[model samples]
Target: MAINQKSFDQVTGALSSLDRNPQAVRQRVVALEKVLERAFTVPGTQYKVGLDAIVGLVPVVGDWVTGAMSAYLIWEARNLGMSKWQLARMSGNAVFDTAVGMVPFAGDLFDFVFKSNSRNLRIIKAHLDKHHPSTVIIEGEKL
Candidate 1:
């Protein structure tokens, strides 16, 4: 079957660029989630880890680099109206991840499991769902 690749691409592009609205924040969150937590598959295992873990292998410098990238999620969450406590929780996660990530080989393993970006994304999504309900829509129903 010959498919119209251009049309498909256009549709996907539109769907993926939902950053115009407040709830569209999920788009960026999802992007960060992919980069920080779910970018690759480990051979012979069902686990996935992303650039955050890969970069954390570079000793001290790597932890800083990945920590900076992870900060973007907290920034976005703040802009999306996450509360102070929520922000603190998110910050705590990032701090812990970065601090532990400073360890030698164990840091890489920590990064694989302690996905701060994903955790922060969940908190942001929940806050948006509860307080700014209009911002989120799910399964064709308004949240």
Candidate 2:
């Protein structure tokens, strides 16, 4: 069934409001990081894998797709007023990941270990904790 224009507008409006909320943004970034870096566990092993590793198994296109996803974290950071140095560092992480990830077997292996999205998530969390304390979600507790 097709959604009516009014319903679509309402949904979009609600989403736009959430986009402006730091807490919502934090939650989104955290979820994306998990999906990108820690979504699956290997059988008979403690090791975890995520889309970044699985998708990077493809050739060059995979790296580029994941790299763009990584960029979203940095974009959100900029929206939150992160320092230039911080953004540059995050960008470097993404660029390095994409560049190295262009290699064949080595790049696939690197994708499994070098989680740039996780690193970027850490940076974003630190900034949020310091600047947007209200967005902080303590372990085992809902904010």
The numbered model that scores best in TM-score is 2
lDDT of 2 by residue, 70-115 (tens): 9988988988899999999999999999999899999999999999
Over the stretch 30-52, how does candidate 1's per-residue lDDT look in tens digits? 77888888899999999998988
Clashes of 1: 0
Q: Which stretch of 10 consecutive residues in model 2 shows the poorest summed lDDT?
A: 15-24
TM-score of each: 0.78, 0.86
In model 2, pairs of residues that clash are none
Report clash pairs, candidate 1.
none
RMSD of candidates 1 onward, in order: 9.4, 4.4
Minimal lDDT window, size 10, model 1: 15-24
How many angstroms is residue 39 displaced in model 2 relative to the true structure, after the best TM-score fit?
Answer: 0.3
**lDDT score, candidate 2, position 108:** 95
Model 1 / residue 31 / CA error / Å = 1.1
Candidate 1 regions off by >4 Å?
1-20, 134-143
